[model samples]
Target: MSSLNFNLQEMMTVAASRMLAADDVCFVGIGLPSAAANLARLTHAENIKLIYESGTLDTKPKTLPLSIGDGELSDTALSVISVPEMFRYWLQGGKIRTGFLGAAQVDRFANINTTVIGPYDAPKVRLPGAGGAPLIASHCQRVLITLRHSKRAFVEQLDFITSVGFYEGGNSREELGLRGQGPVMVITDLGILEPDPISRELVLTHLHPGVSVEQVITATGWPLKIDADLKTTPAPTAEELYLLRELNARTQEAYAPDGLST
Candidate 1:
């Protein structure tokens, strides 16, 4: 497929989608994370169990959900449970394998900040506070973070740490007894970042079709590390693109202002 046919967001979503396996149980977050998780379900990970914080279990939405509470989630879900059961029994009990998340700001260690952009007391941008992300990050067996790559979003220090990713890096998360392994992959428009085996700091492991190592480094707020054996992410396949575009088109139609499909 020609590169022009797909944009960076599509590539990012596809790359993130590929991180899941058919047998995985994914705890999904909203927006980009939700899109990537659903794309995985529609394509490679057909049997992947998708659970939402809103208590929708095994949801297979034909169209992307606008929020956790979106009717489409519950409508297509295998079953609906209470939020407490969703978090306590399923999430904290270690039933979740992959935690798909998005963050407003992410530090070098993959520490997520979705609270405030500036300061906690008086913020430049007040983002939606952490929902189930903290528990999702800490309890799931592993996590996959997806967001646009930029110096602002990829920060040296977050305004506030809403979800712990490796905490202070290294064995810090282990020290704190966080059950999950923390973020295993951080997928972005430019490429993929993985935590170093020893240091636990995020490092550039793969670059997208047209992205460069310098571009990834420049986009990061901190002094990013480059893997010794860097790789290029395979461009989105025709089937992947077809499924993603179809899903998006359906979403637009479902949300059309006149309640009509254009």
Candidate 2:
């Protein structure tokens, strides 16, 4: 790919990497979040602790696992425990530093809906229900969500609140006896979103290269905030792109060689 034709997935990876710090204990999900977390682990944040929901703690996989239950995740993990211990003793016990997740739908308050698109009794689209997301969102020190930008995915109100964000706003999480930073950042294909200062609602913080404010607004179902002097997300450097592609290629080779051949 040309420098100008930056891949959206790669951009999301870059954005996700920026959210992590060295030695962070990340509760990582599969797919794009996994890619970004692994990229961060291999690149700048070598000491980053990777925790999978399948009872793997501080896992150092050579490549991405196809899912939480992938044998490689266990093979390469530091240690594996019972699922209950993983959540009760480690995650909910305040051991996790960050929780990274992706969403099908996210609202202005950073509320996520990964379960359904319409009413509970009657339905439009029944999405995959939350696996460990609600607990992760509640217990992790902070959460980072990633998704592609579109009006359909970014709704005014989610059909089902699978994971809590601000949770009725105004420090209600604290009132409800939940601790941890709700959603620190949301990395999307269009831009980066952070909580609004006043409302604590998700607002556009920065736009990716070649993306316009109007484009972001058009894609969002609700009105989005824009800083007058918003800066564009820096294009991925050649080195960054090279590392990301190599990582992806290695993952493909390990998990789907036959799939790639076709």
Candidate 3:
């Protein structure tokens, strides 16, 4: 029996935020990653350095920014530099600690595809494509991905590899000269996945409270690995729920221009 006071999305966001440490220098993306990063900054990690690709360093936004280059990213930032400096002095220089990302598609090896759904030229749908994921995933000390679990999103092979996770797996990233550790954990709506040390394949390590391993397995496209001693993800604390709700309310307020309810 589990006490699920918060909604699944709330639990997922709070669960993702708890993974970050206060001292971490995080490369922020939009959506779930943004929510989780901001939640961490507000609750436990006040000193977390939030870096944006648009050169906003150490920003503290009360509401979620619409995009990487959103005005709030610079307005609330300690200092805003040029995009070149962000990529050169920060990302390539290895100053960023962890990359918080949201992927469109991922494989067993954690290789990501945010580019296209099908073939390169003739595709089902063209996606946003890789912006800074290639660099961030390769250069950051670690990475954390947030995405809803589904067979379509988690596949045996990615349609297009946009970021390097374990590459071919088992020291493949090391061989590729990637500076970072690649993806450390994948936080899904259902549970958490971590890489196997020997195989470098993602394995289900924990299921969210009230979630069954069978549900997660059904959502995955490939034959997923599960730990023999799997554990339940900690339910969101009262404080975590409050903080996340406040953040969400603030985001809604920011986007509601005409004072209409969001």
**Cα lDDT of all candidates, in order?**
0.92, 0.86, 0.91
Error of 2 at 236 (Å): 1.3
Give lDDT tens digits, candidate 3, residues 1-262.
Answer: 4356887788788889988998989999888899999999988999998988989999999898888888888999999999889899899999999999999999998989999998999999899999988999999999999999999999988879999899889999899999978899999999999999988999999999888889999999999999988999989889999988998998898888665557
Q: Which candidate leads the pack in lDDT? A: 1
TM-score of 3: 0.96
Superpose all Cα atoms of candidate 2 onto the true structure and report the RMSD in Å to 1 decimal: 2.8
- For model 1, the stretches where C-alpha displacement exceeds 4 angstroms are 1-3, 258-262
RMSD of each: 2.2, 2.8, 2.5
Indicate the worst ten consecutive residues by lDDT in candidate 1. 253-262
Please write out the lDDT profile of model 2 over residues 6-116, one tens digit for every residue.
677788898788789987889998887898899888778999989999998888888788888788788888899999998898988998899999888998888889998
Give me the displacement of residue 64 in model 2, in angstroms: 1.6
TM-score of each: 0.96, 0.94, 0.96
Q: Write the per-residue lDDT of candidate 1 for residues 1-262, one digit (tens) a residue.
A: 3546788999999999999998888999999999999999999989999988999999899899887888999999999999999888998899999999999989989999999988788989999899999999999999999999999899988889999999998899999999978999999999999999999999899999988889899999998999999999999999999999999999999887864448
The C-alpha local distance difference test score for the whole of candidate 2 amounts to 0.86
In model 3, residue pairs whose N, Cα or C atoms come closer than 3 Å (at least 3 residues apart or on different chains), thus clashing, are none
